[model samples]
Target: MEQQPTADPRGAIETVFRIESPRIIAGVTRIVRDVGIAEELAQDALVAALEQWPRDGVPDNPGAWLMATAKHRAIDLVRRRERYARKLEEVGRDLSLSTPHHVDEPADPDAIDDDLLRLVFTACHPVLSAEARIALTLRLLGGLTTPEIARAYLAPEPTIAQRIVRAKRTLATRGVAFEVPYGPEREARLGSVLEVIYLIFNEGYAATAGDDLLRPALCEDALRLARVLAELMPKESEVHGLVALLELQSSRAAARTGPSGEPVLLKDQNRSRWNRLLIRRGFAALARANAVSTGVPGPYALQAAIAACHAQAYAYEDTDWHQIATLYGLLVTRSPSPVIELNRAVAVSMADGPEPALAIVDTLATEPALRDYHLLPSVRGDLLARLGRTAEARAEFERAALLARNARERALLEERAVGLDRPAAEGPAGTAAVRCGRAGPRSGGQ
Candidate 1:
């Protein structure tokens, strides 16, 4: 057993686990032939390292060490079962009980790609249901813990845990192969997988709960996964679309939160904070998506265009709201929803005036979908404020504040309501950038 190095072995273990766990699990599943059992074996390997590495010093190749440890567990699992001989035969090995416990097999790194892709496909299989596939894939492939998955979805830990359990059982019982789909079946399954990845990124970019507005870890993880998938499936235009959308959205993460972690509205945030490199990459990906087909823009590619408009503008005042409004119009027709319509109304408000936007929002007031959505009222309130309907705007602000779950968002809305009755605090046009009771977007990078 090798020991971890002097530089905090636990920290080293944690980092290595995050980077290497997926590969280890994928590799181990090949030897054990059961993803559920393979995960158990991989966990055992991690436990072994936590105990042995501190005393023996880190191995030159930590990943290889972990892989080897996991292999030992697989061997033990096979040997302990009455079906050991049968399993050995299945693996194309000698079934003699007297034979050495160590399995005979050549290391094949190139085969890892097929195995990993298979694992992803299996985890994202339609058989497991959308939410189940997402939770299972994130747990196994995204290097995310069950708790992490629970937190990401705003679900209880036990609920996430149960979903994972059932998902894996369903895969095992159905004998789902760890392989990519081909033809129409492939196209359909791939779409579901892409949707999962998109949802993961969206949740991270705007967390549903907790005090913090963003979870960069989830966003980065999703981006990394999408980028890898894009490379693995280069011929698919939508893969590139998803990758492009994520990278572009992630670029704005730095600008989304203020010094004290308050939300920053799009038009008010500092454009200088956006990552230029990501913007260029997004544009290139969008171009590739466009060149791939003459079909109407897919959801991701269309959304990328919207993001591009914001990314290109050097300043808030210079933004082309009219083009954005037009794009949103196209988006609503192509993919109609209250969310898109609400967003379009915002653009309309900026392009036309509060009156038209209010009318659009008012139409949605009877919509069951937007009935509980705080953003609807928030948008309505902003439009009303712009229209000089102080009394209604103030009421709407208070309603939005009550509807919001995030403390920071609720506080911001409350402040807006309070300000309606009071004078604006001394500052620039962009409301006071409150921190932990402080002010402004901290350029100091707090």
Candidate 2:
């Protein structure tokens, strides 16, 4: 007789950990009613899989295995407490108590698909402040470790630790539900939820830590989640706007880096490498955002509109800076931010001239928010260079270079300042200045 074949051990192990992470967290949250505890239990399931899968051979249905493992752990814990025992009953009829949701095969994809979304809405629920929600959601749904989350946020590990702990405690004490919102509350929370997701995606698109310039995995994961949200919430215009934004932004990944992983400025980047399909999708989404409006566009829609402005141009010179300046003006009114104003200054420079842009920037020098913002000096340098003020420009560039966290960004800024030290006849500033100036718009992920 032929020997029976075992399931692909590594394949099953990876799939179980990857695809099931979100759903398992969601399912666990329903039972525990505490996202932090649910996440810990989910890790317990992950640990079990890592220990068993390689030895027992991969299960034919790995997601079910992980879910089963988490549920069994829950049952064991709840058996010791009456209150927690009631929790098991609350999660759909004590099947969690007797038998977990796992079976010999995968569950219906459609049925379990909503788990991730539910987890997102719950973790992003308005009960938590913005910082708390983002920290907790990235922990539970993004599958990132607390340390990783800390590194991404540029916050100390202890600070991130405290925030997550406080967030979980708040949720439990307040008895926040682990389900989607309803009625007016649903619409109210949707925008913040979407904003959190987009922020995660952007962090991954351009990493702020380590030696890596891009963390493509995080970006793709975020993009996948956004696409899912767009499909699930098709009626929400901002949902599509976010999806469109991610799709279009990600399309440039291939060309955003040079031969050695150095950053590539937009003007110098090969436009041919950009994905036309994504651009089209982005345009359509902007149109949708417009259609849903009785008045001004939401933040995401306005940002998408701004991104669309860049996408419509075939070349950098062909871009409509005047219209971009106009969009930034509206963006400021809807969402007043120094960062947005900094972005607007770039468009203002291109449309009017360096003088007006410099004046506008000078007005923002005292802004508390822009005090540590490297782009402020970076923008000032570009405008100064445009007006034959190289000495001042060099100082601004050097200041920007010191404040920049990204290695590639700092290198480019230093290079520009060095270049300005040499004498040359004044004309238009180099393509590099224009390119580096664009960094002001994107570097802060504003």
Candidate 3:
């Protein structure tokens, strides 16, 4: 029997489409061999649903109905092309587009999973630029609209629109294969895919330039993708590692901001606000990653370990900074990035003292990669203030504020700079005033 019609059919259509669009597009792409065409066909399915669902009543399995509609359209398009015979042979096994009795029979689970994985690899292919990969992945897999993506990244809608269009065209013209690679090639491509997801989460975790410090939707989307990838590749240790890192970092979202949406430094955040469920999930993922490791842990696993350290501490003062600093040392060896080094310095400051950590920061000051990085000056300012150099510390904070793009972060830095002017007895202790930049590794804006 057909389900009763939804009172808000359009709203129901939108909600279902948003959840199922990625699967619909992936299944269609398997048949059409073109993401751009697959997306258009998915939209066509949405149009059909809008016109029919209200009149006929909603289907019991709306997602399957939409997927079936999109897949049938894709088959028809393939049959119309001049090279129908060749294309049909290539995708012949997947051409079983006969109308089902219920119009809601789900596709083979294994096939659908393969199609989704292929779509992830295709969207994150090395052939596309980083920005293009990000825009396209969010569009196809994250089910984000162009305007939503543009707003998330603070870019113009037209620029994002053009970037996505060109990315699809580039993939088609270059004949990028829609399949997961193997061996070393797979390893390299996997890195690209992971990086794209990481970058997306980082942007949401700490917006580079925006009125708000956090974009929770982006974080949710990225976390969803990471979870999907982990399920799809359960044996891949780094996949679990990425999931662990994201889960642990996201657990702090509730306490990262104050009542007015101002930034909350790590030392000041209320630990009770952290999501205990996500923290437990993060720990399980980290354990899975460590269990599967055959050698030294990968960069993500190491980072997850560092995050786990923070989660284990009930209070800021109880945190095991020595272990965190040690993990950063391991991370530096595995990743060897200036940003990682900068993060290590922050951990070192807490583990040892400001003087030793300041020495480490001074060494990085001349590194070209960190010349314009705001955290460099911000971290330095914290150390200087701790060491009784108020004048230099204030100057560093002012410089950091000038370089910061996010309004909230810039205001925080400016506040620190101005606070130095207060009389010694009136002002908070220098150690108390120090901000730790990002609460965790790679979770802050550049």
Candidate 4:
């Protein structure tokens, strides 16, 4: 089937390319064996579509059309490099480039899935720095332009461009394979992939530097990538767990900020604003993760379980703090870090009391990892306020505000500190105290 010709196909071309670029790049990379070149060929295919689609009409399967066009360009590149014969033998019977008519054939779904998985692993390879991996992942898999990514993270456009360029150069120079790894290597690389996605979502959920508290586009990209990974590797429990965690966290996006974009603490947020659909999807994904698990739940699954506890509670007072505390305790054993411990302390405060939780926080005060972490002082301030140590609480809040990088969070912390001096009836009530519990475990590298 062919779409009827339109007066101008540019709009259609742009829309289709944005949706299909990742698949096109992945498919082309399968032939070119270089992601950077694969991206260039995908862009070339888009150029071809812009030049020809208006005259010929948009194809019925625009995605397949773009994929085929990019693959053809990739084949031509390989031929010019004198590697056509070797590449033909390398790809073997799967090589569909022998005839031009093959472009009309729909690509194999299984092959496309494998290629996308390969592209994911390639983009998040360990050879590149974390920032580079994130920049490249957003560019290649998220289909985000350099400026979009730069705006999302509040980095200079040229800096992000340099990071992407350096990342691809590093991946190629290091000879990193495009295929997914196996056994121990697979387990390790899988963590890297999950970490990258988690970091992206965290940055969006609670931006570190920008005036905005939530960058919805970054969150959407991370969620989309997680969902795709869940489909591509259905058997991986942590993958599903990652999907679940992100879905549940995203459900609260609507309620996380006030009318004027101020940070809303968990206790004060309107639960009615939560996205029930995302919560249900999160629950389903969590069930899938649990169903496929052979041993103990992974870090992400445990965190999702904690989030589920909050989702189940209609009111802040109804939340199952004990269950959340138990899950965080288990998470600590699996993925021990100062951050997890701090999160666990928050849950413990809710379930037990502030006194014991403060003891936990005090012990962690000496840990170098938490020294610069603003949340540590933020949590400590909350605990101190709960225990009626108003002056100390105000000091801690001031310190946290000073340490915070995000303007919104800094303002919230400053308000908390100032509110401590107000009369009991006028003071900010439970808002600041429940911030940590509602925010969930910052385990994904906040």
Which candidate should be chosen as best, given TM-score against the real structure? 2
Candidate 1 C-alpha error for residue 22, in Å: 7.4
lDDT of 4: 0.77
TM-score, per-candidate, Cα-based: 0.70, 0.74, 0.68, 0.67
Encode model 1's per-residue lDDT on 111-184: one tens digit a residue. 65556666777788778888788888777766667866664454677989999999989888888776677777
Worst 10 residues of 1 by lDDT: 436-445
Output the better candidate (1/4) by lDDT.
4
Question: What's the true lDDT of residue 217 in model 3?
Answer: 62
Q: Which prediction has more favorable lDDT, 2 or 4?
A: 4
Candidate 4, 299: how far from true, in Å?
Answer: 0.5
Q: Tell me which of candidates 1 and 3 scores higher on TM-score.
A: 1
lDDT of each: 0.69, 0.69, 0.77, 0.77
Model 2 misplaced regions, further than 4 Å = 1-31, 41-113, 138-163, 422-446
Clashing pairs in 3: none
Candidate 3 structure quality by residue, lDDT tens digits, 1-446 = 85776666997898789768878898889878899999999999999999888887788888888988888787678778866677777777865655622764677766776786688789888889877887898788767678757644446889999999999999999998888777667666787688667756776677666577877765775677788888767888999999999999999999988999987777777999999999999999999998888899998898888888889989877888899889888988887766677777777887787888889989988887456557778888888887789999999989988877778888888988897776432112222222111223243211
Candidate 2, run of 10 with poorest lDDT: 432-441
lDDT of 2 by residue, 344-415 (tens): 777787788879988988998998656655667888887899888989998999998887666776787788
